[model samples]
Target: MPALASHRKPRSRTRTNSPAVGLTTAAIASVSLLSAQSATADPKPSIDEVQKKVDDLYRQAGSATQEYNRAKESTAKQRRTVDRILDDVAKRTDSLNESRRALGSYAAAQYRTGAVTPTAALLFADSPQAYFEQSQLMDRLTEQQRSTITEFEAEQAAAAKQRAQATKSLESLTASQQSLRTSKQTVQTKLAEARELLSQLTAEEKARLAELERKREEEARRKAEARAKAEAEAEAERQRQEREQQEQSGSGTGAGSDTGSGTGTGTGTAGGAYAAKAEKVLSFARAQIGKPYVWGATGPSSFDCSGLTQAAWKAAGVDLPRTTWDQVKAGQSVATADLLPGDLVFFYDDISHVGIYIGDGKMIHAPKPGANVREESIYYMPIYGSIRPA
Candidate 1:
């Protein structure tokens, strides 16, 4: 098996037709050998070819690792399936054995009775055919006892065979998994070694690399911000449309309500409620724009949908759980339109997504992949319901 390392040179002009999992380790080792060959003053491959080979090995190694994991899971599951079935058979056989013993005791009692009344039974045997029938009946009863024993033994034998096969299969899968893992580790090791060997670069090279990375990050941030701005504008328009028609004649003091009356109309904080806390929550939530959305992230920087909600609530003298699944069940139930700005909105049936309701049919969410924290029309995603912190 080839040893894999993270830093390895490329293998060019070679066709190793390697198993996806084991190939990486071998590739890494090969690269190491190739580097040594270079030290021997052998003609070096073109730079482009070398880079391409390294890239190919990296891609191949990733795919092989994934494949190996999937295969190991499948085989292990299969072994478990077979083992469960055989266990069920063994339990049945055990029950049958107890019944067989009871039947044997009954047969013995009958045999004792027949022996005690042998003369009477002989006298009652009125004809040759009747006697012969009695004898055959006794033989048949004995055969039935033998048949029960044979059946029990057969079932046990079958169970044993199945168990052995399952064990063998499990062992095989375990061995294969270990082999793949070892090969992957070997390749990663070799690659890392090679990369270290070739890591000596001029200060200019390092500076240029840093500059390129910075530019890439700048471009990515610009794109994300543009997307956020567009979404926020669309959300503002949607909020206007949704609340415009729902204004009461005497506009309620709800902050989400439009102040469209000849008098005063605006969002209202709950009376005798945590006013300062709610305000802090609203601020913290709105401030977290363009934060990277990582699944299950709850941090000073990155966040997921539920993570944002939990953190925002925590800032406001409230506590929420860390995951969407847990946050859904963390609060009191409120009517569909009864949610406040700090209320949590659940999305999808499985409760895997959550966002804070911003009132007026608007919500702020991390959204899907590639989208950062941004305000959006609630209708953009499936709305499961709302939650109020307990």
Candidate 2:
């Protein structure tokens, strides 16, 4: 119980540092109830159930981490692509500038050679003055050519704009990559946490736990087989018993015969396929390994005392009304020593709690707050009785 307290705190009835309670009359009642029903020991579940759930959690986290990494890589590749596009814009802009400069040079050369077509100039010039004037005109023409280059540069200014847009895109992609990387890191952290949690369980306990689990499983299988056989027998016996009772009552020979008919009729299906059905009920109980214990809550989520057992059986296609009291009414009374898997074990005088016994001395139930759903020793609780519902 202390170990259970360490994990999940049972807030309603149990508290931190609380001492073990006394096993009084209420506890005795639970044990007696079980004894009056079946004659078998309650078994604990196999360790395999716990291990498989842990392994699955690790696997899920790992898969999510891998997906995040892939997304990060995709963002990185997009960033590189954006960068390459920006580089292309830069080179194109430089080439355009060079083209403008070359155009200016050609225009200036044409102006200086103005032979009136530059040749006409050579004929018409009468003095060195004329030649000097032409040279001056050539300088003016070079200025016009410069203006033309400026206009061409302005028209092609789109390169700068495109480069700016590309730069923005590159920045965006880089930011996206960073975000994805952060996501990947977060998933890795979760995986680490899960792994650490699993590591806390000792190897020896796991092995012993597994052995217990295997035997328990075998026990369940055999019991199911036996129950099937028993049910057939019980059904036959019930029918025979009922017929005899009917004959006696019809002849008005005995009132005792009427009681027999009622009893036999009610239990006609007893032992018939009860084990398989019980196994299913137990199966559902075990599915809730990590579910946190809650106070007075019976649910698919948080569970309290009888809530866990009732819900577990419900999942297995058995309808158990909520509350321990309601559950106690479902099965045949069996002695505690005769309790086995599929039997309902009760606790407390008020029947505040109950669990489905698998085999051995352990039973699976949502013990209390702070403890995950687990198998506990029958001796751990003030066990009252065992109820076999077939």
Question: How close is every model to the real structure, measured as TM-score?
Answer: 0.37, 0.32
lDDT value, residue 379 of candidate 1: 54
Error of 1 at 269 (Å): 25
Q: lDDT of candidate 2? A: 0.61
Tens-digit lDDT track of model 1 for 140-225: 54665545545655665666776677677667767666765764575465455445423543566546545654665466456545
Candidate 2's TM-score: 0.32
Q: Which 10-residue window of candidate 1 scores lowest in summed lDDT?
A: 259-268
Model 2, range 1-390, lDDT digits (tens) per residue?
454436766678645453334446557888898886656664433456555555454434433433454455567677777878778787777776675555535544555643344434433455323443555643554565545545555546767677777878877787777776775666566556656655666897667756865775676556545544554565567666766876877854543343322111233234546655666777788888778875445567877656777676676677765556656888689876566567788875545567777655567877643467887656554567879765
Instruction: Give residue 377's error in model 2 in angstroms.
Output: 0.9
Best-matching candidate per TM-score: 1
Cα displacement (angstroms), candidate 1, residue 16, comes to 51
Error of 2 at 212 (Å): 25
